[model samples]
Target: MQSKNQLVELPLFAEKQVTLVLKREDLLHPFISGNKYRKLKYNLLEANNSGHGTILTFGGAFSNHIEATSFAAKEKGFKSIGIIRGEELVDSWHKNTTLLKAHEDGMKFKFVSRDDYRRKEDSDFLADLTKEFGEFYLVPEGGTNTLAIKGCEEIITEDDKQFNFICSSVGTGGTVSGLINSSFPHQEVLGFSSLKGDFLKKDIDKLTNNIRWNLISDYHFGGYAKISQELIHFINEFKKYTNIPLDPIYTGKMMFGLFDMVRRDTFAKGTKVLAIHTGGLQGIAGMNSVLKKKKLPLLDI
Candidate 1:
């Protein structure tokens, strides 16, 4: 699945003293792109290895993992089950095209109450889900399994680029953890979070066993799935200048924070950096709607 894409570097930071290369995992899969592919590849192989007919996992209403996993499962002749969080009914089940496509791809979605999803870590959760679904392959929320990390770790092993710093978004920390574990002992990794507060940091740290790294606290942009006009504009100008589509939900915040840090001279001269494009491009379908709702200038025309 990974052989279909290529790696391209983005020169950043005033084109002076620092440059960031985007490990373009975004182009890996058209239907379900970016780090989602690497994270699920091994798990899918394991599912096929185990002879399981279906894959079960959890995510939110607009979750990229859920969408990707759904298409991937159906493409490989396995079914999918997405355990969605939140109890409220969305205005329409057809609101999200990606989720709708997943349904067409043979995904069996089970929406749980907000309270039940919060206890997702407990053994009872797995027991209940297993009992409900029978003997199917289980992929945890965000697809942060050991197998996924092992696959995500390949981002670092790709080539011999000795970057001083490596950064990625911290959704489930699978990508960050894998990149850190795959790097040289002295190289540093800075995971920028789109989720607010210290809760996400603690979760990523706990999931990390043998690797130690850094985390920046100032990013988030009002928490996960939250966005600002400034960010939307940034996404627009970013596309205009680079011609690369950045999904606003995750990678946009990372790029925003990264640009801010770069302007501040975060790294010393000649410091090379790398950032992972953990794709969320499906979210772009709503970009035009959002910009128009805010009366922002259009870039598509």
Candidate 2:
């Protein structure tokens, strides 16, 4: 039996001859959704098969990865540990927050200095973490691994609809890289960088063996977790047309860039595009929460 929900087909807006179709992978699960689920599937299974009692990973305060891994590991009967970035905020121990929810549900966490987390490239640094966790299976930050990429590739194959172009927002580049690897011939895949200083093409190349693709860097607004009024206005406008709300973190920037590119005539006449909605939509909860306080007009989607 399938454990998750059905894929959501979110509509797109096209001007001139180009058409867009969004594969809403966000709605795949309620507790922990999107590509996070796909990536963790094999990782958790392997951890269990190896007889590891604990799963260790890393992420930030709003990390979909840490949240997903925590719940998934819980369901799969493994202990979860998140090496969080920075000091825990005051009142942050409560599980109402997603990260804290992980902790509440038996996911253990340890806070580390940002400077120390930045040293992840150092083997000595990882050795320290591994020693602290004690024989845990380590999932990289963002749940990225070769096996994870393979699982995401299956998502690309699920849709047979022919598309001239594909795009998605990139955090660690796992989903976008997998989409490129599994895309049908003649389909060009593009990734929108969600963070500043992120070299997604380079990062994907490191995880992907021989998967060719494109990375569009112009759409991030102001890197990860940043937005502007223009973005808000566009998000509202997009929902007016498509009845789907794009969270500012990922899909919102993607649609913004896609539309801008269309206006700039980057896409030729009659082009068809497929944008994967790799969801981290809990960002919307925080977003809409803030908007409610400001009493801004909400998009009715």
Candidate 3:
């Protein structure tokens, strides 16, 4: 579905003489929202056509991919299995809102240690999972693959060509890669990495040859799934001002970085920027839970 681009009427944009519009992909669906929906569309179709009865994927405890995949599989009549990282959550999974919702949507979880989870792509790991769970369609972590990229390419329609810059939060690199492949030559695509390192550049390069893209690595906060009080305060304030809720992980960091860059005069005056709201709003509750434990400020829902 084509999402509406909502104009963000922030004072910062007015002061900078730049236009910032958010492509509200977050409103795509309650569960399978934003990039997750784009990433999973064709992958689910392939699984159904291939006669697969079960869908298996990997993710962390609060992964949007894991939650979205579970709901989509249930809706499409496929059994879902989540190969979750963090064996420590084997007993505590029910406490996590994301995992609990996925479980309610008919997902069975197989928790593994962080090290074993790192071997998720190894042939031996797949063989072992095959022996246990029987044959299933394997959707890579973050639900990114060739089909996912193909789906994500559809995110940028003819209407998006008016923007001078296209911005998105980078997790598995598939979403940004698709944006790069489909973006206008004159438009620069910027990826705000949710992860700490520059490793995603190589992953994205493998998917697209377009040189109109750059990965910004400065706003990860700490690393994947990491957050701080400043970020929480910004997210809450952003929602208050714009009535748009942002998750602590991907989209919040991307928005924060985008606004900061604007404050630093990174974009020329009269530039039109479209920041994609790749939904991970479902993770906010879980993130708030963590924040409470740390005695930090909470993200307003």
- Among the numbered candidates, top lDDT falls to 3
For model 1, the superposed segments whose C-alpha errors exceed 4 Å read 1-15, 158-160, 209-212, 286-301
Q: Tens digits of per-residue lDDT for model 1 on 1-301?
A: 4432223344655465686777777887887788788889899999998899989998887778888999999888897888888656344556666668778888987878988988777888888888888878988888997898888888775463577778888887888888778877668888988788877777777666655578776878888877777887887888787777788878889989988888787778778777888888876765555566878654332
Scored against the true structure, residue 123 in model 1 reaches a CA lDDT of 88
Candidate with the greatest TM-score versus the true structure? 3
Q: Output the lDDT of residue 278, model 1.
A: 87
Model 2 — which ten-residue stretch has the worst lDDT?
A: 1-10
TM-score of 3: 0.99
In the range 146-219, model 3's lDDT, one tens digit per residue, is 99999999999899889999999999999999899889988999999999988999999999999988999999
In model 2, which runs have C-alpha deviations exceeding 4 angstroms? 1-14, 88-96, 209-212, 287-301
lDDT of 2 by residue, 203-256 (tens): 888876644577888888888877777888998887775566677888889888
For residue 301, model 3's alpha carbon misses the true position, in angstroms, by 0.3
Q: Rate the local accuracy (lDDT) of all candidates.
A: 0.79, 0.76, 0.94
- lDDT for model 1 comes to 0.79
**Candidate 1 accuracy as TM-score:** 0.89
